[model samples]
Target chain A: MHWKEDSAEEGDLLRNALAGCEKAWADLFRMHYHRVYAFAFRSGLSAEDAEDAAQEVFVKAARYLETFKGDSAFKNWLYGIAHHAVMDLLRKRGRREVLLERLHENDTTSKCSAAAKHTEVGDVLGQLPDDLRMAVVLIYYEGKTHKEASKIMDCAETTVSWRIYIAKKRLRKLLEKRG
Target chain B: MKDDPIEKYLVKLEVPTPQQEAVERALHRSTLAFKNRVEPKITQRENTVFKWFEKYYLAVAFAIVFAAFASFFPWAERVCPAASETSDLLAIYSEVKMLFQNNLVAVLLQGSELKVQLGVPRNVAGARVMFVEFSRGDEKIKVLCLEGSALRVPLQGKVQPVLEAMPTADGGVILMGDSFVWSRAMPQTINGYNISARLL
Candidate 1:
């Protein structure tokens, strides 16, 4: 169901969720699952890794439900969680040089057609700064407008636009450097 | 050959579409994960006071009124006492949360969030009636003010000592202090209209 934080507020949700409403928590999960999952995938996770990361995001969301302010859209909150989960995954995959080289290869693949794009683009998405990568994914890949992207990003529209611009510039520079 | 291969190359590059299906699956799985991680607590008929009614109501009100005149300072729940019957409390909580989500009260009140916990009736040695504690997030002021008088909640179940509440409007705040400061005008519903309470 659509989330109306005012219905129970963040504090109440936490209290009730803490009380163990499997259904309510489930509803909460459905509300922002996709936003977070795509965030993890676009941030450079494999399909499998993205799935795992999504789980991690929810675990954290459940644990920290009490603190959630609902001040921003739930999408932004989930994305924030996804950002951390992806970062954790990236750090765990500490073969930076090897990974970078693979991503570079993948970058080359994106240069071609969209095929093999999954393995290739997925790797580099995590390589960009969380702020920039999120904007790029939300805008170009996810097909969200700057305003909607801003709602999800919980930042000003200008910030979303700037991130998109900078990410494109950076990706272009990286691709060019690879060549 | 005609133009810079770099700019020419860059212009034609295409960013791949994320698997919307992956997002969908992730959402579903995420919901499950949330449910799994949410280890539900067993609720019992608790008999603690909500923050609105405290024994020190006189001092609290004095302080609050004094503060309102001065700084308008206000204060606080009994600790989170779960319902005695684990299974029953969980059912009640689910129902209450659902009702709260669908209620018109939410739309009317902006930033008016509900805090719910299960309580047992006061003065009942072991009443099975479950009191669904509902309060607004903005009642911090009243809590601080009425910290003295333990407000009698309308719900039948025994009250728990502490229930985590936010700072909202008069969303039916109950005092958990030792004393009380409320007189029942009539039997009215607290935050969760599905539940009924006796105002003391």
Candidate 2:
């Protein structure tokens, strides 16, 4: 019942936002910023980069509001924008390779103790391929349903399920070595 | 998926969150950008009579209704006007109960005449009302109004329903439907009805 009410309120907010109500748009930004920032951070961006990416996502969403029909959850649409912005940032900086190389160089330091390994989950996540890492970040840390994740990730729903399955197997192996 | 240690650890991963200051900064920037984009339209609206109505239609409409009822019925003023946030037509409907009938009148847009079946249920009523149709792709909805009552077109293809029926003080009945819109543009033709109305 609460879910229904929230959905109705969200629908109204979307309508108002699309109709150019700045207050509604700002409310939407505040409500979803954390998740978009978390997705960017978990994808291995620095704090500054993630914040920038999240802000860009919201601005772009406002610019493209007319294109968003009431076809899916607003967050799904938003995450789609965040995904592209973060990926673009990563591509422009060549940041993925740099982060992966840094992860490898830190492997010796992580191998020193179980305590060290436990502290290295955030670093090790950078070593996962981007697709799998994003799947993991969105589903696990960000707590999106598989279907919603699929829409944001621009893939089939079953593919999201498979990515999550594969990501878990990989994360389990990495975390076990750390422990 | 559930109770997996790996999942637990992943959930525990420390991720960066935007600080409150950062959030406020971003919101201000976005809102400013949106305002800039929309400023011209707002400027244009400021000079329009319709903009005047859009802003003050409620207070003025309520004042008119209140004055009409204030003479004999002291309780009329105390009756809360429906908050004007919804639509102007709705405000009128709430004050005048007789206008709530779901009577279907086949509106021939060209004639500006509402065809009325005198004794039939939901077939007719009286008054000049505006009908507006909005469409996105193939989806369409018609907002119908009469006197002060209005209703949305049914998606199930049924004729519009009568919203309310009440006898007026003059020994006659006023039939109305509970639906209305703030604007209307005639479509070339309603799907199942025909008229010489200019529709685009």
Candidate 3:
């Protein structure tokens, strides 16, 4: 499902959630769970780990709802939380190299065309460092501008631009080698 | 940008959607966790006290350290030596006057003791040092009441006189001779001045 940026609706849901409305919290969780999951997955987490990371993001958002002063879009704020949650899970599990190996093995073995392509993409992303991979995923897969990607990744715009440039160069080299 | 092959692959990458049942389960868990969360209720008075400590914690810590050092170490009292020494001198004078009025001379002059005299006060390291003399024939026992400062006892004669110094509670010292029998009237000195004694 395509999730549009609706600040007014999100603000109302957030206010009701803060006012102890459980249904409002559930609504907010359902609305953003898919995008958070997809973000985690495209950021080099396994499907199961992405699900866990998404759940963690919503729980944290609910916990720190008051700190959101509506300075930026709630989507950006939620993506910020998602970014940290995914990175923390990655760091704690120490499975980046292992996941890369697994993705390469799946890319070579998978017979289905769509699954092969998806695994190939994951394998290529897994080759980039965590920061550069996040830059590529946020810009290309998530369709965020450099400004929004910088905010989500907690870096300067120039840094994001630099990372994307380096990441694209390396990805082209990697894809050419595969071809 | 639109014709870029790498961007095209990344944009077309398909991420597996989480099952609807898993989403519902996660929502229920998050809702339960949110409802179970208890924010601490801070009263206005408690908040004010917290903010007060936050603001003046450095000054309060400094005062506590100063007070602790002053109580533990005698030399820290040198910071205000004049006031302490003066009060100690007054206490010693009042005790000596009471001893003289009671005709305690006979008890003090048990053997060859003739008389006792309070000498003039002298300044030593910003503290007043008073001398009490107990005379017996040609021999005299001198007691030095040194207060507020850690100054060495002043000895006028070449003789060492066998000095003994006892520390009082308020950072003062009582120095006396070994030959004399010191009948300690008050064992514990209050405000650093309890030197009421008769020499035998």
**By DockQ, who's the top model here?**
3
Q: In terms of TM-score, how similar is model 1 to the real structure?
A: 0.37
lDDT of 3 by residue, B1-200 (tens): 87999888786567876767767777877887788755545556798889889899999999999888788886865678757655664565446656664222111221353244333323345433444444434444444343322222233444434333444455434544544323243344222223343211
Kindly report which residue stretches of model 3 are placed more than 4 angstroms away from their true locations once superposed.
A1-7, A97-113, B37-200
Give Cα distance to truth, residue B89, candidate 3, Å.
40
Q: What share of the true interface contacts does candidate 3 keep?
A: 0.43
lDDT of 2 at A163: 83
Predictions' DockQ, in order: 0.11, 0.18, 0.30
How big is the positional error of residue B142 in model 2, measured in Å on the Cα after superposition? 60
lDDT of 3 at B128: 39
Provide the TM-score, chain A, model 2: 0.79
Which lDDT tens digits does candidate 1 get at residues A17-36? 65677666766666556556
Residue B102 miss distance in model 1 (angstroms)? 75
* TM-score, structure 3 vs. true: 0.57
Q: Model 2's chain B TM-score?
A: 0.19
| Lowest lDDT block of 10, candidate 2 chain B | B191-200
Q: lDDT by residue for model 2 over A66-151, one digit each (tens)?
A: 66655676777888998889888877766665565435535643322343343367777766777888888888777888888888
**DockQ rank order:** 3, 2, 1
